[model samples]
Target: MNKRLLAIIAAIGATTIYGINHTVAKGIMPHYVQPYGFIILRVLGAAILFWLISPLGPKEKIDPKDYLRMIVCAFLGMGLNMLVFFKGLSLSTPINSAVLITTTPIIVLVLSAVILKEKISSRKILGIGIGLFGALGLILYGSEVRQDAPNIPMGNFLIFLNSIFYGSYLVVVKALITKYHPFTFMKWLFSLGVLICLPFGLEEFMQIEWSSLPFEAYRGIAFVILGTTFCTYLFNIFALTQLKASTLSAFVYVQPLVGIGYAIFTGQDNLTLIKIVAACFVLVGVYLASRKPNRFYQKLK
Candidate 1:
């Protein structure tokens, strides 16, 4: 019941939903909805949900100076991040999306060092090299010609770019979370996200024939909008209040385990030798990059 434990649980819950989303969201796109159109539903749905509950949190107004930072966070965290990721998922395998997203912790580590002035160790630097090597290998050579995945390489690349945007958002939003309630921050963040992303998604959003879609499609869409977008972001924001950005981001290591397992279980994706090997490199790299410095080293210093 302590804050740290709750934060850990929240981070785990968010990552688990995201892991499953690799398959669930992908199932809804290009057929039930295009990638951009799906993002519109996600942002718009989450915005409404957040606004509905905004009154439960303490009443507080954001400082005018913070508006720019909030807008930037909205764009990075929700707008381009979600847009690029869902597009990539539509064009790539669930396992690939899962593995590629593991790079987020590494990106967060680097960003934290640069933006937050967190110290970086040689071990973490080496881990970065190894992780990027695996990610790049997957992007360059993990291509497969499948009915579902049209362009694997490009999709993987976009997913990688999404990690950068998402990682940056985590670091940037750390300051804002301290100043405002999670509900307040999230409602406005998602509201701005609706405005930022609506233009790109409106045409596709309108094309959907809601009544014609099957039940499975509806389930997938609901899971994405409610579980993936609304819940994950809310959980992560609450987690951030009690944990460091780097610490919270490190929990992304859990994604591939849940994602790959669920994907295989549901027959949505299968693991290749290359995928297995690349995943090893990423997991090892993440372990190195995310581990805390030894107390002995600190004492020696």
Candidate 2:
């Protein structure tokens, strides 16, 4: 198959893993393990996996000048991105996390325009406005009292912050992905992540009562480390090699559909009228923001 098709599949695979992770990862937090501690496990585990497989990829040395960019990418993509996300998930509903994550396309669009010097058409600007409005609405008003979710507004805000970090990472990593093998880029990226996150998570990581944890919690942790962190990053990095950052980020549109459906099916979260409406706004905004201007105008013609 063509590289484009393979990239699409990789992006979709990553999105699917992330969608399910909303619930699966959340199931292990604050009780079995706190959010920051879980991040340590994720980064450390993925770092080890990446290192183990790094030998198979082409041996290419990174330019010394690119070291700073790699460190920034690690902080944005793995450290702060995962840290805030899991913390947000621990304090927010699954559906809320799912819906909020769909805004990544919009965030990527804005970041691309600013950092990558990509053009933003009128439609995209309007989409950004509408998308931010929907996201802000959800953050301000989408509260529900639940045992699992302690601070819904704060959680939603943190999740939004994660979108920015993650979106920025996508745009910034594009250049590095072009220069280095995904294995090479990711191994170092995650190694840096371990150091960045270690200070915050070490105390909590030590507090875990591993012997007392149930089987399901162990399964959840394993899935998070193996599937969510390792596989998803690999898939996304591969996808980035063949797709634009915006195009790869656009695949986040599938996340809420998969995440919400799984959450509802598993009895982890439910939808409300406000959530439904906010989701509509965010999805429409994402569609507009990610649509190519030439293609959109061609359809009009």
Candidate 3:
């Protein structure tokens, strides 16, 4: 297959995994592993999986200078990013958490402009503004979610913080991945991410009730490992090798639509006119931001 087709396939696969993983994590897995513990295993499992696929040895000669830059990306991207998000997920309702997290793309665009010196077009900026308005509407409606889901406002705050780190991770990935092997970067990134995250997560890991948790908990754990932890990041690195960070991060806006669609399919949420309108705005905004300008638009200018 051509590189473009391969990149599209990878993006779809990654987005599906990420969207479903949120449903599983926020809707299901909190039944067993607390947030921090869950994140630890995610990193640990991903670290092991990447290692099995691409062995990391002390003898590999990645210049410490370059490797260290990637390590900082890991610290911000995987380590602290996961820390804040799972903490938020642990403390609050998934609907609010997921919806608030959608704002990352807006944050990402601003950060990209400032940190990476990527130029933002007027159309993209307007899209981001509209996307934020839609996201806020979701957040307002999301607060009415049934008490079955947790509502830790602290968790919500952390998840937003996670959005920042995640944005930074992408910029760094875009800058570095071309010069290094994607798998090489993945192996070391997760390895260092685990190391950076360990201190915060270790206490929670020790306290988990492994014996009492159901066998199904293990199943959920596996879903997180395969879908959320390993594949999502790897797919990201793979796609970013071909596409820019802005293109990849644009996928963030589509996730809520995915979540809502899944909810409707499972009979968990009723499809409403308001939600349809909200979803359309988000999609329109994302399209304007992520896609290249049309020839007609360029000619008009």
TM-score of each: 0.90, 0.90, 0.80
Poorest stretch of ten by lDDT in candidate 2: 292-301
| lDDT of every predicted structure (CA atoms) | 0.86, 0.86, 0.67
| Candidate 3 segments whose C-alpha is farther than 4 A from its true place | 1-8, 56-59, 95-102, 139-141, 152-157, 234-254, 267-281, 293-301
Error of 2 at 152 (Å): 0.4
TM-score of candidate 1 to 2 decimals: 0.90
**Clash pairs of candidate 3?**
88-155, 91-152, 92-150, 92-152, 93-150
Candidate 3 local distance difference test against the native: 0.67
Those runs of model 1 whose alpha carbons end farther than 4 Å from true positions after fitting are: 1-11, 236-250, 293-301
Cα lDDT of candidate 1 equals 0.86
Can you write out model 1's per-residue Cα lDDT over 197-281, one digit (the tens) per residue?
9999999999999999999999998998899888887798688778876577567688999999999999988989889988898
Candidate 2 has what TM-score? 0.90
Residue-level lDDT for 280 in candidate 2: 89
- Which model, 1 or 3, shows the larger lDDT? 1
> What local lDDT score does residue 287 receive in model 3, on the 0 to 100 scale?
66
